[model samples]
Target: MSQSKSGCKNAQAEFSRFAKPLVDEALAHAAQGEPSPDDFHKLRVALRRLRTLIWAWRPLLGRKFADLERAYLKRPAAAAGEARDWDIAISLLGDEQTKPDTERLQTARRDARARASSTLAAADLKHALREMLRRVNRELNTSPRRTPIKCLARERVRAARRALRKRMRRAQRANRGDYAPWHEVRKGAKRLRYLLEFFQPVLRRRESRRVKSLRRLQDRFGALNDAVATEHLLGQHREVFADAATADAALAALKRERKRRRRAARELLG
Candidate 1:
């Protein structure tokens, strides 16, 4: 991987070059009726990976590609999310005692498990995902080649800074203390990290280290987001469980876990 004046451009090109074959093969396997679960899973992983690469390189290509890629990805990622949530919810059943509202939570978990299972079975999620992958591949191949890397980098940075400043000001108004400003700071940090990572040619290891620290901060926020989202999903299906006790317990456990996560984020930000 020789460095080019346009590392972001090269990175995007490499991602496209490698992703096409992987997606094509995965789609073929899924269409074969006897698609192995492993193969299907591989396809999903490939899509996620490619999407991540696109995210990291979004400064190079601008928001259009980002929007288009995300549009194709939303459904597939949602299907995967449902399956993932079910897996997590079901595991909670076995660990009910460790959680605060074990009895109630278990009930909720059971209900969630049943619903998730039914949804997974009825939905041709793999088929839809395969078709979506096919479409994405076609789109990528035909997408425009030129990327205004320098110009886009300047704009992306400016936009990121503006958004961060706006958010920080709001947070200050709300009196969120340190957490508010920290949250806004991390957003700016992430945009910088992504931009630098994509534009690797001019980026140095010292710069990479700084960006890595910012990424750690971003990760802390991401964890909080995940827990909140997951808890809501589990809570929404609480009525389906036969045991209210288990559901309540699970919800309580999730609350504590969420709190713990928030504290961790605070520590990192601080």
Candidate 2:
């Protein structure tokens, strides 16, 4: 089960050994026309875990398979995104606020649920899953997994550090008034954070500490994004507004919150 013994190619060997069974299991379930919600949920989980596993091993594999990985996995993740978004919205608003926005939120929740259901209904996902599993298994079968853990870990660390440096530079170059550039800077920071998190086991303690700081930066940006989404959602449900003054005030408050969060994100990241 452990591929760490395979000197230089530990990550690739480990990923294949660890993830291949999960992929195979998911594909087999899909092929059997499994209709249970729990089955689909398991499939989705398998896909996500495989994707994360590959991402952590990407440096060893190079960019050649990046497109293939995205093609097969990203679509399913997108199919699940709406539901996840609604879940996030609910979690953010808390139970107390759920009443006031129940009708509208319910509609969004239903749409997400529908997407999840429809995604499983589509045979392409099943076929795609099987096909991807076949390809990955084929590659692993032929390849010796020659890359050692040390080499793989070094590559991941180098790449993550490079990404962090690049994002910090971007933040330095971003203009105070240019929210777009700052947003991009935040995105870069997030990538570094994710990379570090994915490879945490291989990273040094100081590197992990840096990863935590970068994660805090990402969290700040995520909060700002949530504020923006909240503002947009509130505006879109204008028909539910009881009074003109209240609606106007709500809109204004939304905008103010977004503005404040953005500022806070920038300060925290800086």
lDDT by residue (tens digit), candidate 2, 23-102: 68667545544234445556666676667556556655556774568556867655655455555545544334223356
Error of 1 at 135 (Å): 9.1
Instruction: State candidate 1's TM-score.
Output: 0.57
The worst-scoring run of ten residues by lDDT in candidate 1 lies at: 30-39
lDDT of 1 by residue, 1-270 (tens): 444455445333454554556556545543444333343455555555556445545555457866676556544544545545544554444463534344654565455435544544455546655564455445455656754344444455456556655664554454432344545555555656665555444444465566677678678765655566667776787754556786677778777777777777667633
* Model 2 bad stretches (over 4 Å): 1-9, 17-52, 59-62, 87-101, 123-131, 140-145, 171-191, 233-247
Tell me the deviation in Å of residue 90 in model 1: 4.5
Candidate that scores best on TM-score: 2
Which segments of candidate 1 are over 4 A away from where they belong? 4-15, 18-49, 52-66, 90-94, 98-202, 239-242
lDDT values, one for every candidate? 0.55, 0.61
Q: What lDDT does candidate 1 reach at residue 167? A: 60
Total backbone collisions for each predicted model: 15, 5
